[model samples]
Target: MKLKFTLLTLFLVLISALSFAQKSNNSQSIISGKVNISKYHSREELKNLDKGELLTLYIERIEVIVNILPNIAFATKPGVTMASLGIPETKDNKKALEENKEASDTYFDSTIEFQKSILPYSDKKDLIAAILFYESTLKALHTYEDFKKD
Candidate 1:
């Protein structure tokens, strides 16, 4: 009788664990679907915008990207460290990593400033090109980040 009870208990625990795993997977899929929907809506909104409006939106989006640069830089840093307790030396290539980060910051800042300056004078084609450039950059960065997570 005790052996049968132990087997039944083990089976129940295994079933519950499997159910929990399935729920976790379902939640992840839901989140991924939401991201896709959001991207689709953004593209639709951009497509419907007039030239002047699109330029304005482009400038605003560039500003937002600039604001998030620090976070992106932090996340993509080559070295790993926990500085709170004063423990360092977690990773190597510090010099090269800092140089690459500085270069990226300079490039992004310059591109943003150039886009802002020329926005008022830009036509539909110019605006569309700028939009595509920024959008693709953002998409690439997001994909890279996701890849890093996995």
Candidate 2:
């Protein structure tokens, strides 16, 4: 009786442990870096990107906002002055804009914005180092271009 009871208890323990294990999600990949999604933007930031005058106009406006990022990053990396864009100081206003359900469909229609949303949860923690590591990990795992489809 004692032997049978011990064996049953061990089997139940193993089954519970396996049940709690984390499984991989098909939509995302884990690369070798980190990033902080919350620091740069919130979910609301993406929604606030447009005034939503009209569906077509809103899309165009959102596209313009999304398209300028690479250029700004490249330009600033080279130490270009604010005078180039006529702005006195450059700011990283990557905060997620508030979502407006009535304005348009899919606030984060672009891959870049979608990628930003995933950053915060990637590390499972909100520390700066975790975020940086998560950013790199994402880059190593997936391409930015594919983010939209994801």
Reference-based TM-score of each model? 0.40, 0.20
Instruction: Compose the digit string of candidate 2's lDDT tens values, residues 1-150.
Output: 999999999999998778766332121111111111222323344334332222222223334333333233323122333344444332332111112211223433544366445543432223333333433543333354455473
Winning candidate number (lDDT): 1
For model 2, what is the alpha-carbon lDDT of residue 74? 27
**Local distance difference test, per candidate?**
0.55, 0.36
- Candidate 2 lDDT score at position 87: 44
**lDDT string, candidate 1, 14-75, tens digits:** 99999999655311110100011123125556677887778666765565455344445344
Alpha-carbon deviation at 124 in model 2, angstroms? 42
Each candidate: RMSD: 13.4, 20.7
